[model samples]
Target chain A: MENACCIVGLGAISSIGLDVEENYESLQSLQSGISYPEFLQTLHKTDLPVCEIKKSDAELAALCKMPLGLPRTVYLSAIAVQQTLAVIANHDMSKLRIGFISGNTIGGMDRSEYFFTDYLQNQSQGQLQDIRYHECGSITELVAKHFGIKHFVTTINTACSSSANAMIHASRLLKNNKLDIVIAGGADALCRFTLNGFNTLMILDSEPSKPFDENRKGLNLGEGAAYLMLTSEAIRSEYNLHKYATLSGYANANDAFHQTASSAEGNGNYQAMKEALAMTGLTTSDIHYINAHGTGTGNNDASEGIAIQRLFGENIPPVSSTKANTGHTLGACGALEAVYACLGLRDQVIFPNLRFETQMKDLHFSPDTKWQATKNMQHIMSNSFGFGGNCTSLIFSKDS
Target chain B: MGVYIQGIGNISAQIFDPRSQDFTLHAGHGNRLICIEPDYKDMIPPMQLRRMSKIVRMGIACAKAAMQDAGIVKPDTISLGTAYGCLADTEFFLQKLITQDESMLTPTAFIQSTHNTVSGQIALLLNCTGHNFTYVHRGHSFETTLQEAFMLTQENVNCNALIGGIDELTNNAFNIISRFGTYKKEDEHFNNEGKGCIAGEGANLFVVNAKDTKSSYAYCSDIHVCSTENIAEELDGFLHVNQLQASDIDTCLLGLNGDERYDTIIANNIRNVKNARTISFKKYCGEYPSSGAFAMALACKLLQSNTTPMNLQDLNAPLNDEPAQRVLIYNHYKNQYHSFILLNRL
Candidate 1:
């Protein structure tokens, strides 16, 4: 279909790796990147494990060729976006109607948190430059302006589902002929604000997260940025682009059950998965694998597991949560997992759900804990459920 | 096909009601424009009201009000745009995390601090399990939300999308932003040739449908976003795309804040517009990032009432006194992000 949104380029920066190739390598070897915070200066750093990218903001800035003292979010986003654009460097970018749609929970909060430490005491004490890019759009603008993306630029902040919605919106825009190419995904940097915020919620597991495990404690906070260059099938054909995968179906549904908790019945999760599959005109058996949101939280695993059971029922696919390796990256997780899904489809492999032992009693299926090569793996489902009851499911089909 | 604004509910610096031909614009207090809020008891439940921050309260109240005005108990989708999301909650959590060393922090403030809290709350309140999204793209936040809603309606004819734009002006935000010189001096207003604009906060919600209903205020014909460079060319293209000309527009609403530095671009662009009565909305709603929403609401009001409000001003040369059948809204933020919205009388 000419309306199909094709993923032509991929970029990612997380604890496991700095770019898509490194991330894929780490995933293949089951190299978990969870460790205690070394770069982040926090009181709870010793207790809380995180998927830090193992680089300071200065190192990231050096990599992105941008100035230091800016928010880490900017550096991460710039690096990922640069890598994404590098894949399409052979194409005449200026000739195409290009746009950038990014998703981030806190714009420059990494810098703003430092500014707030002083400004909270005295309004005039903080550096103006530190807090200048505090708005989420500001991060988007800094990157877009640097890369010269002036056509369409926006930000989505639906908690964890932020980047998933960004991809969804980008596809809609492409399907509607609003833009020929869109760099759509999200980024986030580890900071005290989110650390303590999630800490206060008491969902921070002391160890690396074990998603879908029966004895899962909670989610370990992680930080990263990932992006996918999506283009219309027409543009893909015209440019003879190297296709990674096709963004077949997606849906955003509200749980409406609680402010931060998923429903017991996983109503929103079920609806999002159901609707996404419906959009693809595919049945449960058509889906080859599932990348579960599976935050390793007691609430999320149960709710999401029950929803998966309700949807696929007896013929559940090999489901796994990569958060065990990357930790829950929150806003960036959706797109991060999406890149991984594309990688899985490309290689016809199912990356195991790391550190899973006992299965949840609420469901009949256990997440695949061993990496294995598979045949005829055509479609993979990625789930992202966030705070405020925001649930989104995205389905990616292997390029035929 | 264009989407119709079936209903509007605004909680802004001004008292706006589409049903009322005559309305009042409350004067801003010092350098900031505060919303003249309504009682929350009527719109939200008491228990839920206590947990919600000021922005959430205003957002949910106005969303419910818009839904009620649209004569629907639930909408097919709920989307919101907020530039500064849940400032009070964010500030509360940040301050507590700082002062108390993040030791005894609670989850309430942190829970409410996310940008989608308001939109999520609206969905939870109505038990409307549909598509929910929140855009925080600075100036184009609301316009992006409107665009998303418009696309949904165009894709699905039976979709009724509840969309809104909201932002709150907290004390800390005001103080810090004042340091950035975003607001005029305390002694200065628009009339005094100020270098900055007043800080404004508001929640404007609308129920839009692809099919026009009896309660529809106006039909939103087109919405376009463009960069600062080649704005005049883009403006002409926008009009041409809509099968219109400068003369076809009865009223052109420009986002001209009192700030001379930023308003110059808007001022310079108006030269390309001819035979259209130009109106500035910042004078009434003050200046906020998503104030384009207020401009669109005002355009709907003018179209619905068929009479101009008492205190409305024409920034450009006066034109014929005919009621506006076609309205064009041009808004830019920091001269960086610009959008044009066209509305027509039903």
Candidate 2:
């Protein structure tokens, strides 16, 4: 890992905790953020348990100086990015050409759902500026403008694998010497559009999700934001930035089998993982931990487990799905789990996979249910598979 | 490494079918420039075609046509850009969720509602297991996809990447956006009432590889994406890096949506590059965030034909006496995301 793009700072606002340190503490303490929704204004709030941030929109809005009527997605992004910038407060701001590569699925649909409903009822009832942030890049543009990061700004929306692809591009930009500093991550807040969308898909587990379990019913949806500050060797040396971990390799592949469901053999997942490991020239023995994209759905867990068994054979590392804790953050899970992986590297510990009892009947390996600390925490892999069969995998290793 | 645009596919507000040798030039006559729908029954099976929205069908059709023109079976990679992805589905799902109290909602619309649906579906149809990417950076979406494609082709000259941009408007979306003053009223046009512009959308794609073939229309030399504050200076640096001067550019395509407020940005930025002939492609494709794809398709066509369409012929425009060998496409979204693309005649 010579002159790799190092993770200098991390900012996360998830159900587990509101900031990087809190999130790390929650991971170490094995505290689950899967609780009833407090802020989301959906009818299923009473029936479904979600890992939602406890702050109301107004409370979260007061955290930052944003204009009124912006979507909750923008608020979450601002909170995470604010913390990301705060982590690198000592960096020479004027000298740095910062690039904000944010990933989001539904930009302001949380607000748009409200606006459009009002508009449907009465065309003139909704505020004019509310629906303006409906597009996916709208939040990225707003956050970039707020942070004054104009050098290289972009947004990726590959469903669940979005933030993983965002990190892939961010690392590539740094490796290509396009930007000095890259803030790469994603943010997605819960809205009726996504909630009912998943509900219609009939994958929303009413109870806590158990990944890699045989009877795993479905996924418990969640909402949050996470960002990692990526800095190259030149910027690292110039600014004397502290490296938390190294983003060594990443790969993206399509299943080409189905739109929402993965292939029966998990072709895309296997290819993504194999290529990512090949990128770093690392073997299965070298990988210390596996942060699986175990969404608790029957199709996803079985397919991902098969992919893992194919890659690792009989020798599998400690595998876990933090979704049991933070729920699936949709697009932000990549960066959220990325921050968790960096924590594993920095602290040399493997977090527990919450609420897992039985292994899937179809697979040889089951996710680690209890928190386990480890000494040889070196290379870690994170997987994020999305709808339309878009799959991505990322590797993080100790900054040598 | 240079990327050669080996093939192009365009389905837009204009009736210029790329499959035909001659293009039927459609002038900028109306504010609501609607895309001339293509017959998908020719390319897609009924099963797949039934579930796809207008944008998804258009994307798949364009991608298939582009691959056919390039003599490639399947692209090694697929990257796409879209301002509003599957908007028809998004709107449908939203309307259902709101009206139906979030119950009894169908998953079909929700499944196709993602921004990457178009690119993912293209790969699925082609069985392309290679790299797949989608960019949603408003105006920079198309340019970012081109940049990703350039890097891929540069990495391996043998690699052929299918990259494109697609955007389609729904009726409710258009109505709401128009009310937000996005589009000029039909009667309000032809006056200095620069408060609104025409609404338009399209799907355009190009097959790019590092090697040139008989189908190569132009060579994509460089692409620059930046903020709109200093477009002139940034474009100068971009051209200088490519060893091209402003005068070296034979044709320049700018996005002038008839909105004096935003179009004036380009006018002021290019006030100095007086020697290059400038034309606005929005007249044909109208205006959309991903309109740069239409502009790129037009550049490929102009470079291949060695002649500008009569509809865009400006007698007083700075037309180079020499044959048009190079073309530049520059566009922005609401005076924010600035993009410049350089294409050279093969």
Per-prediction DockQ comes to: 0.84, 0.79
Candidate 1 docking classification: high
Error of 1 at B74 (Å): 0.5
- Rounded to one decimal, what is candidate 2's iRMSD? 1.2
Q: Find the candidate with the highest lDDT and give its number.
A: 1
Residue B197 lDDT (model 2): 81
Q: What are the runs in model 2 whose C-alpha is more than 4 Å off? A: B17-23, B188-193, B319-322
Tens digit of lDDT per residue, candidate 1, span A68-128? 8888999999999999998778767677889999999988888788788899777789998
Candidate 2, residue A321: Cα displacement in angstroms equals: 0.3
**Can you give the TM-score per candidate against the true fold?**
0.98, 0.97
Query: B99-203 in candidate 1: lDDT tens per residue?
Result: 998799898999999999999999998998999999999998999988888789988999999997899989888889989888899877765574898778889
> After superposition on all CA atoms, how large is the RMSD of candidate 2?
1.6
